[model samples]
Target: MATEERNHVSNGEGDREEQEDEKMEQFFALLRSFREARDKRKHELRLRDHEEDINKKMKKSKASKLGNDERSSWVPRFEWEDFTSEFEFPRPLVVFPTPYNKKEDQKNQEDDDGLDLNLTLSSASL
Candidate 1:
């Protein structure tokens, strides 16, 4: 009877250890599932926001395209014949002088010096 009692006590302790291990496993599985659900929710929110943004951009593009189409159909307010008849030959083509020529510039400088020398000689004679 004493030997049988020892064996029964040892069996009870083993069963208790197995129960604790099973509880720990269940807790870990529940935590993992909760984290996965939270992540899925976050991903869904981001996807919805992205879809809304794309929709808004598409709407703006369509509005702008409609405005452009309307503008393209516009006709000139004046008659082509009336415009041509009233137009005068844009005042005779005014030609601007070209850049200075090196030869002409040197000739002008020499002429100026000669005039100054002649003026000095005449003044001295007086």
Candidate 2:
């Protein structure tokens, strides 16, 4: 009876050790799963942030293109004097030659000559 009781106690201890090992394995599995989930969440958040950045850049590029297109089609009906008076500085001028027409060419020539005479007279006076 004494030997039998010793055998039973040893068997119980073995069973307890097996149970403890299984519990440890289960705990490790749970930890691994949690880490994987956390990493996945971080990856998703990074992708979302990159997508938002791309969207903002696209919007800015589209707006700039629209502005450039508007400027390209813009026609100024105001005179140089009106522009200069508003800006209050020596503004760079862009001259667009009118289509070939006899009267227009003659008028442009006369204007050029008048401008030259004005400059010469002003320099002489100074």
For every model shown, what is its TM-score relative to the native structure? 0.48, 0.50
Report the lDDT of model 1 for residue 68.
83
Clashing pairs in 1: none
Report, for every candidate in turn, its global Cα lDDT versus the true structure.
0.87, 0.86
Worst window of 10 by summed lDDT in candidate 2: 115-124
Residues 1-126 of candidate 2: C-alpha lDDT, one tens digit per residue:
999999999999999999999999999999999999999999999999999999999999998988786666656588678757755458768889767999987997975665453435565366
| Model number with the top lDDT | 1
lDDT of 1 at 28: 100
Global Cα RMSD, each model: 14.9, 20.0
Assess candidate 2 and give its lDDT. Answer: 0.86
